[model samples]
Target: MLTPIPLLIIPLAIYNIIAFLTPGVAWTSGLAEIAMMSGVRWTLTVSDVFLALCLFVLLFEVMKATRISSRSIVDHILSLLLFVCALIEFLMVPQAGTSPFALLVAIMLLDVIIGFSVSIRVAQRDVALTAAPDQ
Candidate 1:
């Protein structure tokens, strides 16, 4: 049995990692496909849902980076690499230009930027406090 936090975090982390690591193809990946008919008919795939999940996770990461009191350099650096990898995949990989993963990459980049910016401000404030004597 896993604790609540790890239970929630682990699956999402794995999903993001797998999604990032897996090679892209002529089409997006998904678990299931849905058929719809309205004037015309089309199949909507799980990749659409994955995009929503990615966006939700991105929101979580950004908020966590901003709200968490402790800042880890390694975490931010890894986020940078994540962003870079996604960017490279988008530019170089086949069919990625038409996929949602490109948006995920952009979100990762924003997360890195915001996380570093907030961490720097927090560090500066801490330095000011530590340097000042009790007054």
Candidate 2:
């Protein structure tokens, strides 16, 4: 029973790590190359990174609003749906010059780590919430 908060944060943390290791400039270059090969002329600017960060924050807010509980069947289904969609997107997207196998492995690893972390966090939160106050 992974919680959503940790589920989201772990991936963001991994992204931050990757970003730090590669830096924005190099990332942009790689993105540009891929985009060019895909016939997508999108510019990989600082704004793109900013936009991603903003989206991540928005996702976190959504997760907070929809607090997960063990009884939330809908939440579980929705999470599964999201995972499926992400898998489809990763598989269908053009890899261009990038190594598809490596990208897939990384994406899968990220998904697993985030999912597990979130489940644990959610379970912990549920316990804390249900705990009775000390007199």
Task: Supply candidate 2's per-residue lDDT for 118.
Answer: 68
The digit string of per-residue lDDT tens for model 1 on 18-121 reads 55676452234445544555554454555666566666766666555544443356567667776676677678865456445665666676778887898887
TM-score of each: 0.56, 0.33
Best by TM-score: 1
Cα lDDT of model 2 by residue, 1-135, tens digit: 334433433443444455456553333443332357668766664435544554564455344434555534444455455446545545664431233223433444444445456666767766754668899
Candidate 2 segments exceeding 4 Å error: 1-51, 58-72, 95-135
* Candidate 1 displacement at residue 31 in angstroms: 9.9
lDDT of 1: 0.57
